[model samples]
Target: MNFLPITKQEMLERGIEQPDFVYVIGDAYVDHPSFGPAIISRLLESRGYSVCMLPQPDWKRKESVQEFGEPRLGFLVSAGNMDSMVNHYTVGKKRRRTDAYSPGGISGLRPDRAAVVYSNLIRQTYKKTPIILGGIEASLRRMAHYDYWSDQVRASVLMDSGGDLISYGMGEHSVLAIAEALAAGIPVNEITYIPGTVYRTKEMDSVYQGVCLPDYQEICRSKEAYARSVALQYENTDPVTGKTLIESYGTKGCIVQNPPAAPLTIQEMDDIYDLPYMRTYHPSYEKMGKIPAIEEIKFSLTSNRGCFGGCSFCALTFHQGRQVQVRSHASILREAENCRRDPEFKGYIHDVGGPTADFRHPSCEKQLSKGVCTNRQCLFPKPCGNLKADHEDYLQLLRKLRELPGIKKVFIRSGIRFDYVTADKDPRFLEEVAMYHVSGQLRVAPEHVSKPVLDAMGKPGHEVYLSFLKQFQTANRKAGKKQYAVPYFMSSHPGCTMKDAVKLAEYVRDLGFMPEQVQDFYPTPATISTCMYYTGLDPRTMKKIYVPRDPREKEMQRALIQYRDPKNYELVKKALELAGRRDLIGYGPKCLIKPGKGEQVSPGMQKKSRKKTIRNVHKKKGR
Candidate 1:
């Protein structure tokens, strides 16, 4: 139940000399299952391997990584829970002011491209140590892909980080195999047979029956080739049908990705979460103020892993895969009881779902054995005919939690696929959510109202969202509650046009509400949308798609979402003119904004504008 050793003295106190693994991470060490480093380290500890955490080591000083000295087995490196670049910079490529993962919500604790930087730092001291890369940064960048910040395609992280092996995806199975092999004195070069791992080698002679991707130079030379390679990598993500993939780097070597590890069994998922976790940030961080990241998740329970929703913007398909894996109700309840007993318990459970809440089982029965379809999706384009949209198991789980004596509220904040809800025949799940789970507001992502934009984002059409809203409102009425649906929308996604932006703004104007925050489409690595952003070609269809890359256009599109705000007036006005929608500029009932001083407008329209403005101001004062 103790934290892993972090220093030579702590290692000695634990009666260990040189430990089995030095887990060098890019975050302040938080011993919680929610953090990947904690899960991996605790899993290793449970398997009788000594692990010393090196959280946020000074990358500028090689001696910082020497605190725990060289490990008996190897050094495990990760760029914390998030990709370091994503954490440090906004989607606008502007530097962010705070890092939730760092101590006191401070930025600059971890270096950019942290996995590579930390791995290189370790090499400066322990040149021959078996460095294994894990976590989201290394996992997503395991192969050659586009780097948004660098504005070019980059080589595989395994090549740049100089890591001997990459345990991609949920790494428990591959990591254990790696530890056993290393303990048996197998060299890292010889440990290439493990599933869910990527490695480099000069000898391609041993790579049997593997798919050879376009050479790295070819992809770098051709964006279309890169798109093709992305599609190939995506198809090989399932454990049952996925094949070993090889990416050549000319003479340096070939990077080989073994097929993904099999999804964990229910019992195995239970065992992993049941491992001893202090479930909080390291006590040393107390003086620096609580880690902001923990506040959201401290009371939350992760009931599932993997997603079947198949979101194009999400990197889950590349990391966790599309196969849904869940923990048994008994296991989830055990964790809930632990939370109930905690001193910080407030009779509330923040969340009780994973990638997509309410996905308690695989998308279909066959997925358990045959894996998801390589070329098709379970919930997008339209739900597959075989898609099982049943919510009975999830409903029962929620009901059981509500019946718990000490639990006052059980909420689902991780978001659910509303289209999936609509697909289910039974109406009880939606009814229960509106009645009990929702805390007056249910946040749903309907990304955009434009049909083309929706198709590009792989999200359901606007009509589906509208139907869900009607159903949700009906359920709220039945429960005698005035609940609201807070729809989340994104702007500047690939395939989004100026006209499409206007269409979304009109939809908002009709609703008489403006979203406080808007998400500009961020082109992180390895996502289908990111590929489209960089290549201007849909990786799925290899068709050319319109991408709004100009900074001014991006801002204008964002402004349209909050057109009601005074600050966005000029941008919105300019956007309306550019889209040939100046008709929406005057004081018609459908108009988004009124004309400024000295602007030409009909006398009738001017009178209406004055009346509307007066009503709006009165409404504000009443509030």
Candidate 2:
């Protein structure tokens, strides 16, 4: 129930002369399931490998990385749960001031591109110690990708980090395979055969029947080529049908990603979650007031993994893949009972789900063996005829947890696939959620209400959200609940124009909810929408797409979502006028803003006189 050694003295106390592996992470060492390195290390320790953790080593000094010295097996590098650049910067490309994963809620603990920095630091010290890359940062960048902060296509992270190999995806199986391979005295360079791993090689012969992606040079020279390459990479993510993919990095080298490993079975998944997790940030971080990232998951349980919702902006398809896997009810109940033992337990279980809360299996039985379709999604456009929409199992799981002793409330805080919920004929699931699960407001991601934008984003049309909203309201009404649906909307997504923004504004207006926040489509690595944002070509169809790239336009798109806000009045007015829909500028139920008054001030924007804008002043006077 204690954490692995993070210092040489602790390792010596544990009677270890030299560790089998040194896990270098960009996050504070939290031995919880939510942290990737913790699971892999614990799982390896479970298999009898001595592991030590080096959390957020100072990349500026080689001495910091050599804290544990060279390990017998290798050095494992990860940039933590989130991509480092994403963690350190806002979508506006401004440096973030706080890092939740770091001790004391501080930023700047980990360098940007932390995996690459840490790995190279290891290379500087122990040149040939089988530097291995894993976790979200390495997983998403294992192949050629568009680096947002750099605003250019970059080569695989393994190349930059000097990592001998990379264990991609949820790497319980592949990471263990790597440890076993190294333990058997296999040369690090020759260990490219492991599925869920990426390795660079000179001989293509070693990669049997691998799909050759567009060469790095070609993909970089042409955006269309990069789009084509990304599409191919996504097509091969399915474990059932994926093949090894090889990308040439010039005449001297090639990076080969073996087919993704098959998902773990229920018992295997159960065992993984049941590992000896201390279930909190390492006690070393106690003085830092706890790692902020551990707060949500300290008592929350992850019931499943993998996402089939298939939002184009999401990177889950490349990382966790779409094959849903779950733990047994007994396993979950056992964990819930354990939660009750903690002195901090407050008669509630924060969450009991994973990437998608309701998914306990693949979308359909065929997906189990046939894999998710590469060209289309399971739920978008509309649910496929073969979609298994029943939530009976999930409902039963919820009911079982609800009945557990000392558990007063079991909430579903994770994303619930509303489309999946409405697709089911049974109303009992919705009724149950309305009655018990929602914490006053249920969060759902509609992303955007524009049809074309929704289509480009791999999300269902606006009507799907509307349908779910109506059903949710009816359910809450029947249950005598006053719950609300806080739909998440994204602005400035590819194919979303000012007109689309206006459409979304109209929809939000009718709903009488001016959202406090909106996500400007962040072009993170390895997402179809990111591809479109960069390449202006839909990877699925290669058709030309529109991207709201100009900062002002992106701002306007965001402002339109909250057009009712006095602060947003100027920006919304400008957006309406720019889109040639000036009719929306007048004071009418259909109008988004009032006509220009005394000072000809813009709506949805603040005036710079250090005083309230005309709209704000008008709003204050109860206009």
Which one wins on lDDT? 1
Candidate 2: segments with Cα more than 4 A from true spot: 599-623
Off by over 4 Å in 1: 602-623
lDDT of each: 0.93, 0.89
Error (Å) of candidate 1 at residue 100 is 0.7
Judged by whole-model lDDT over C-alpha atoms, candidate 1 comes out at 0.93
- Please provide, for model 1 over 73-150, each residue's C-alpha lDDT reduced to its tens digit, 9 standing for 90 to 100: 999999999999999999889999999999899999999999999999998878899999999999999999899998
Tell me the lDDT of model 1 at 369.
78
State the displacement of the C-alpha of residue 471, model 2, in Å, after optimal TM-score superposition. 1.4
For candidate 2, lDDT tens digit of each residue in 270-367? 89888998888888888877798877888898889998888899999899999998999989888888789889999888998998999988898988
Over the full model, what C-alpha lDDT does candidate 2 score relative to the true structure?
0.89
